[model samples]
Target: MAAAIGALTLRATRAGLYSRLTSGVQGVDATTYPVLSGLARVGPVTATKLAEAIGMDRTVATRYATRLQEAGLIDRRPDPADARATELVLTAEGERAVTALRGAMESFLAEEMATWPPGEAAAFAMRLEHLTESLVQGEAGRSC
Candidate 1:
């Protein structure tokens, strides 16, 4: 019962926050933030590698990369290891944007959960993490 209620609340709050944040940032969408942050963390990387890393389809990941490129948040450079492939890198502007976005999201989550005691948040996180892993594993099992 607790897990169910927590899941519902988390989903609703996430939707609300995404709507609010997207409205504030022109030309930025859900995937944009993750892709930019991923690039920032991983340095330059191929779209194929990034797609795998982020668990998105190649086409979907490509679209995100294209959108980021269009917004000047990311740059596509020729891969030195593979002449035919391109590596995605975050621009300075993208770095700034992603850093700000991370801070905002963290702050928002902290505020929303502030009333909850510390152990409650950690327990919620652990359960959610397990749920995510199970779901992914189930998909992988069926695909095989």
Candidate 2:
């Protein structure tokens, strides 16, 4: 019963988070956020490498990159190291969006966690990180 309740709670929290994030973000889908985040983190990288790093198929990753580029959130340039390959970089606007979304998400989470002890929040974060690693490392989109 406790495990069932925990599962339900996790599902509900994820829904609530998407709702809140959607309200906060303008002209962006939650699906695109992670791609933008990757661009921000890794600077410029080839689409193939970015796709591998993000655990998505090359074709799907290319689609996501195209969408992000259409939204002016990312720029694709010819790789200096390999002129035939393209490198993805976050534009200034994408950087702003990333920062804004990060802050909004943090604020939302902090609000939700206000009643919980700091240690509990830390533990929760650690557990989520572990789960994410398991998901990514085991198989793409398996644990999620």
Candidate 3:
């Protein structure tokens, strides 16, 4: 199971896959996609917090946040909770990029599963979701 998971992770994270996924989205590549997608999931957050959530280095997150900000895909605004620190928020363009990325990924997966048996893909998706939930829960338990 570990080997299979590792192989899948490698294949899914390859540069080619990222290029394909981000084809239509400008200013987004493998290095920056995680930050963009992470922001979409967690909403406005400090770069440090976003980095922690996405398993990226704080400096890397801050740097990419700046790049994304320059691209007009994200905005850095004063944090409501902390006056000294800023939170990263996705702009309208950023939201659109996320949507496009998701659509592309869905299309890619559909193509990959084209040869699968009628219900097999759906079954696999369910199992994958369950496995992800279980892994997340287990990680939480360990952290506590």
Per-residue lDDT over 1-144 for candidate 2, one digit per residue giving the tens place of the 0 to 100 score: 668547755966767665566555554565666677777777789988887777677887888889988988788889888878999998888888778878887887889999997699989889878976875678745658
Residue 18, candidate 3: how far off, in angstroms?
1.1
Report the Cα lDDT for residue 94, model 2. 81
* lDDT (tens digit, per residue) of candidate 1 on 32-99: 76677677777789998988877888888889999988998888999888798998988887877777
Q: All models: lDDT?
A: 0.79, 0.77, 0.90
Over 4 Å off, model 1: 1-16
Predicted model with the maximum lDDT: 3
Using TM-score as the yardstick, the better of models 1 and 3 is 1
- For 15-123, candidate 3 gives per-residue lDDT tens digits of 7777777778998988789999999999999999999998789999999999999989999999877898999999999999999998998888999999999999989
Q: What does each candidate score in C-alpha RMSD? A: 2.9, 3.9, 3.0
Worst 10 residues of 1 by lDDT: 18-27
The better-scoring model by lDDT among 2 and 3 is 3
Q: Give me the runs in candidate 2 sitting further than 4 Å from their true place.
A: 1-16, 140-144
Candidate 2 clash pair list: none
